[model samples]
Target: MATFIPPGSSNDGADIDLLGKELGLSSGQLREQLNALYARLRLLLTTDELGAWRNESLALFRFSASSSAKATEEYFRVAPRVLDILPPHLFLKWVKRGKALCHDSPGIAAAYFRASPQALATLPERQFNVWLAMGPGLYKRNSESMELAAHFLDAAPALLQVLNLAQLERLLLFLNRLTETDCSLAIRCLDSAYRVFHALEDDERSLFLSIALALVRLKPMASVTFFKQGIDSLAGVTSTQRLRFLTLLAKIAAYNSRHALSFLTDCSHALSGMDRNLHPRLINQCETVLAISAIAGIEFLNNSPAVLASIGPAGLERWYREGLRILRKDEKDGLAYFRLEFPEDGTLERLLVRVELDHVRGVLLMYGEALGGSEIEIRSSDSLADWSLGTIDPGTPATDGTTIFLPSSIDRFDSAEENFTWYKVAVTHQSGHIEFGTFNFCFESKAALFSDSRQLLSADGHGLSDMDRFLGLFDDRRLAADIFSLVEDVRIDYLVQHRYAGIRSGYRFIVQESVWKRPSPVYLPLREAFLEIVIRFSLNGELPFVPEALRGPTDTALRLLQQLRSPEARVEDSAEVAIRLYDLASIIPNTRLPQRDWNAGGSEQARSNRVDTSYRTSDGGDVTIEPGAEVPYQAPTDVDFRGNSNPDMLNIQPTPKDGSDRGTLSPLSSDIGEVQLNSMMQGENLQSGQYTADL
Candidate 1:
C-alpha cells in the first residue's frame, strides 16, 4: 500500500547526507534519527496516511535544513507528537506551512514546530490552518515578531476556552494590527487576553475586543495601557451603566478614537463617588459636548460632578450651554470653560448662587471683631496654616483661637441675602466661642452650675493643655470630647442669643432649620440616639418618643443638657455636664434596639417632664445587655451652625498679650501651640521635652 524508500538507497542517502550536513549531525546519527522517525510515523499513521508522509518527511527535514540545525532538531523533537495529534495530511500541510516560514525566517519555522500538539490540538483542522496563516504575516512584519507569533500559538487553547469564535477573531485581528507597530505589546496583549476575556461576560468580551480594535487603529501606543487598564476602567462603572457607557465610548471611537479610551478613564473616575442615577444624564451631557469637540467633551465629563454639586443640575445645563456657545466662537476659551480653568469672576460666576468668602471677608471680619471685642482674621478653612490644628472640614466654619476660618463659598441657600446671613450666623457662632471664653479653659476652674466630677477622674496634672487634661480623665476620651463639645456649644448659643438681640430671630430660625436635618432618633443605635436627642432638645427644646427601656437614661441625659442652657452657665459647667453625661452614656449599650422597641406602639413612651436631678455614677448594675447586642460606637451627626472647635488646639496657642507681636508665640507654649494633635494622639513617639497628655 505504501512505497517505502530504504534508508541507504542513493536518493534517501543523498537527502540524509544533505540534512546531516545542514543539521551538523554525523552520517550515522542522521540515519538513526531518520529511521526512528519513520518507525514512529508508521506506528502512528495508517497505510493510506503514509502517502503524504513518504514525500513530505524528507521535504520537512530539507525545509528545516534550509533554516538551521536548530530548526532540524526542533522538527525531530516535535514531529512525533504532532503526527500523533494531527492526521498525516494535516501534518503534511503543517510542514508545508513551515517551509513557507523557513523561506523568510528559520527561527520562526523552529518556533512553528515548537507550538506542537498542545496549541494545535485545541482547534479543528480548519481553525488550525487559519492560525498557521497568521504566523507568516506576523513574522514577516518584523524580526522581533518571531517570538510574538510563537506566543500567540502557545496561548491559543486557553483563549479558545474563554472567547467564542467571533470574539477570538476580533482579538486576533487586533493583535495582528498591533504587531505592526509594537511586537512586544502585541505579545503582551495575547498573553493577557485569556484572563481579561475570561472575566468578562460573553457579550462584554465581544464589545471589549471591538473597542480595542477601534482604539489601536488610531493610537497604537495606547494599546499598551488600554489592554492593561481598560477592563478595570469598565469595572468601576455600575453594571446597568456599563452597556450604555461602552456604547458611548464606541460612538466616540467612531469619530474620535484617539481620545475614546481617555474619555472612558476620566468618566469612570468621575462616577466612583457619583450617584448611579446621574450616570445617564452625565452620559447625555458628554454626547452633547462631543457634538462640539471631543477634547471639550472629555474635560466636561470629568468636571460634571463638581459642577453639579456646586450648582445643581439646572446650573450644570446652563453652564454647558454657555460653554457650547463659547466653543462655536473660540474653541480654546470653550475648552477652558469646561475645564474650570477660567477665572471664577468670569461669565461662569454669574450662573452660581454661591456667596464666596472672599466677597464678604471684610464685612464678616468687622462683624466678628465687633462681637468678640477683638481683631479676628477671616480666612478660608481650607487654607489653615497648620494641619496639626486638625482638619477643619473645608466647607464649614471653624476658628483656631485667632483666625476665623470659613469655607470658600456659602452656597447653602438659594438667595444672596440668605447666604450672607448664613455667613453671619457662622461668624456669630465662632465669635461666641472666643467672646464667651469657651477656649479659655482653666484646669483649676470650678463649674458655675453643676457639681465638679473632674477631681475623682483627674490624672495628676499631666497634660499638654487644660482641656486635654480634663478630657483625658474619662475612660473614653473621644466620647467625653464629643459630650463637652455638645454642652459647650449649647452654652455658647444661649450667650450668643441673649447678647445679640438683633441676630436672635435669624439664629433661632437656623436652629429650627437644622432640627429638620438631624437624623431621626428611631433609626440610630441607642447611645448615638441619646446624644442626638440631646442635640435636638438643645436646638428646638422638644423630645421625640423614646423606648420605655431607655426612658430613664434619656430623662437623665435631658437634665444634664438642660443645665447647659442656664444664663450663668460657664465652660466649666459644660465640662461638668459632659462628665455626668459620659457616665450616663457609658452604661448604655451602643447596639441597635429590637424592632419591637421602635415599631410596636406599646413600647413607645413619652419622656417624663420631671426627671431625677440627682447625679448618678457610671456603675449601673441595673442595666442588662443582651447577647451579641454590643456594637462599635458611632458619633452623631454634626450641627451645621456650630462649627467644629477643638479647645485643646485653641489652648495650644498663647493668647496675644496687650501690645506684643503675636507672631512670635512658641508652637508648644501653654494657652497655644501649633501641634500635630491627631498624630500625637495616635501614638507617635514624643520628643523628650514634650508634655504628655493622657488623651
Candidate 2:
C-alpha cells in the first residue's frame, strides 16, 4: 500500500481525515470514534450477511462533511444507530435528505440526523421517506418553523403510539398548510400534537387527523383550536358515535370549512345533554341542512338539543322542515331560525304543539314574582336534577328555595293552551313552596295543629340537616321520607288551591289526570294500597273505595293529612303528620290484597288480608304475616305536578361565596347549624355538589 494505507482506506481514510479536521480531532481520536461506529455497524451487517455494504454505507458519511462541525458530528454520532435499522440504500437516501436540509438550515440538519434513529425505528421505509421529505419543506414554508420541525422529528416514537404513519403524514401536511396563515400556532400544534393525539383512542386518531387537515386547508386559523378544544369536543361524544361525528365534521368542512370545527364542538356538546339515541337522527337532520347552507347547518346543530328539548323529540322533524323551508326561501332568516332567533311572526316557533319554557319563561317569571313578592328566577327542572346528588325526578317541577324550576316543555295535552296551563300549574305549585315556606323547617319548632313526634325519637347524631335529623328518627328512612314528601305536597297544593283561584281549575285538571294514572289500589299490596289511597286523596280529595278491614287505618291517615290544610300549617306540621302516617303504615302487613272482584263491591279474602295482623320495625324487626307472601314495600308512582322533594339534600352547604356577580349567595344560617338553605332556595352552586346551568 505505497504508504501502508489500510484496505479501501484510500477513500475512507481521506474522508475520516477530513471529518477529523472538521471535528477538531486528530486522526487517531477520529479513528477511535469511527472504529466504534464501524464495529456497531459490522455486527448488524454480519448478522444479516450483508457485510459488503459496510464500506458503501461508510462512504455516505462524506455527505455531511460540508455541513457545520456540529452537524457533521451529529451525523456520525447517530450514523450507526440509524443504519442499524435502515438498509444501506435507505441510509444513503436518508443521508442525502439530511444533506438537502443542511443547505437551508444546518441546525435543522443536525436535529434531523440526531432524531433519525427514532423516526426510522418508529415508521416503515415508505413513511420514513415521506417524513424525511417534510423537514426541508417545513423550514422553507416559514423560516421560523425549523425549530418546530426539529421537535416533530424528535417526537416520532411517542407520536407513533397514537397515530399511524398515514395520520402523521396528514398532520404534517396540515401543519405545513397552517404555517402560511399563523406560523406560531402551527408550531404550537406540532409541539402539542403528541400529547393531544395520545388522549384519543387508536381508531379516532386518524379521523381526527383528517379533520385537522381539512380545517387547516379551508380555515387555517381554527387549526390551533382544533388541537385544543377539539379534543375536549371529542370527549362529549361517545366512542361509537365519534366516527359519524368526525365524518360529519369533514362533510361540513367541504362546504363551509370555516365553521367545521364549531359544528364539531357545538354538536358534541349538544349530544352530551341529550339522549344518545338521538345522535344519529340529529346527524341526519344537520346533514339535511348542510346540503342547503353550511353556516345554517352548523347553527342548526349548535342549538339542536335546545330545540329538541323545547319542542320535544316529536317536534324535531317539524322544526327541521320549517327551517328548511326558510332556508330555501331566504338563507338569512333560515340562519336565524336555526339559531332560534327567528322573528316573533316566524312559523318555526309555531311548528310544535307544545309550550316551550323559553316562550313562557317571562310570563311565569312575572307570575312567580307576583306570588312570591320577590325576584324569582324560572329554570328547567332538568337543571337542578343535573346538579343534584340525590335523584331528582325528571319531567317534574321543583324549587331550590329562590328559583321555580319547571319542565322544559309541557305537552301532556294536545293544544298549546293546555300545555301552557300545565306550565302555569307547575309554576304556581313551585312558587307556593317559596311563598308558603316548604323549606323553612325548624326541628325545634312545634306543629301548628298535630302533636310533634320528632322529639320522642332518638337522635342518631349523623344528621347534617334538620330534615335529615327529623327523618333519621324512624327505622325506615325511605318510608319516613316518602311520608314527609306526601304531607308537604299536600300542604303546598292546599295553599296553592286557595291562594291562586285562577289556577284552581288547571290544578284540579292535573290532579284528576294524575288520579286517572294512579294504579288501582285493588291490585296493590295492603301497605302500599294504604299509601296510594292517601296520595289519591291528597291529589283531588276524592278517596277510592277501600276494603272494609283497612278503612279505619286509611281514615286515620287521611285525617292526619287533613291537618296540613290549616293556614297556619308549617313544614314542621308536615313532619308531624308524617310520623303518624308512618306509624299507621308500619302496622299493616305488606301482603298483596286478595283480588277484589271489581264487579262485586267486596271480597271476604281481601277484607281478611287487609286487617292489621303485624308490625315491622324500621330496624329490620320481624313481623307476623298474613296468609299471602309479604312483598317488598314499594313507593307509590310519582305525581306529575308535585315534581320531586329532597329536603335532606338542601341541608348540604353551598360553594364558598366569592365577591362576584355570578349571583352567588351567602350560606343561609340555620338555627342548629350554618346550612346553605338560601343557596338551595336561590338555585346557586352547592359545596357538596356542583351545578352547571348549561346542562
The best candidate in terms of lDDT: 1
For residues 3-107, what per-residue lDDT tens digits would candidate 1 score against the true structure?
A: 554434456456545545544566565557766776666555565555465555556566657546666676767777787778767877887777666666667
Q: What are the lDDT scores of the predictions, listed in order?
A: 0.70, 0.69
**Model 2 C-alpha lDDT per residue in residues 1-695, reported as the tens digit of each score:** 11222334346556555544544554465567666665444333342333333333333344444554556677767877887788866766677677666666667878888778777787777676677775556675445787767766667667777787777778878878887886788778877887788877777788788777767766777767887678788777766677778877877776566578678777788788887756766777787888788888888878877777766764666777778999999999899888888567645446567667876676566556556655667878677644453566757887777666788877655456666667777777877877787767878889888786788874765635777778778898888888888888899888877765556777877778778767778878888888987898888776677665466576667667776798888888888888888888887888876564222433333323333323322233443334778899987777887877656644643331343242632322222121333232233324423222311
- The lDDT of model 2 is 0.69
For each candidate in turn, the TM-score is: 0.47, 0.45
Superposition TM-score, candidate 2 onto the true structure: 0.45
Off by over 4 Å in 2: 1-23, 26-33, 40-68, 126-128, 141-143, 201-207, 217-219, 265-277, 308-312, 315-318, 321-334, 341-695
Candidate 2: residue 11 Cα off by (Å): 15
Q: After superposition, how far is residue 235 of candidate 1 from its true place, in Å?
A: 12
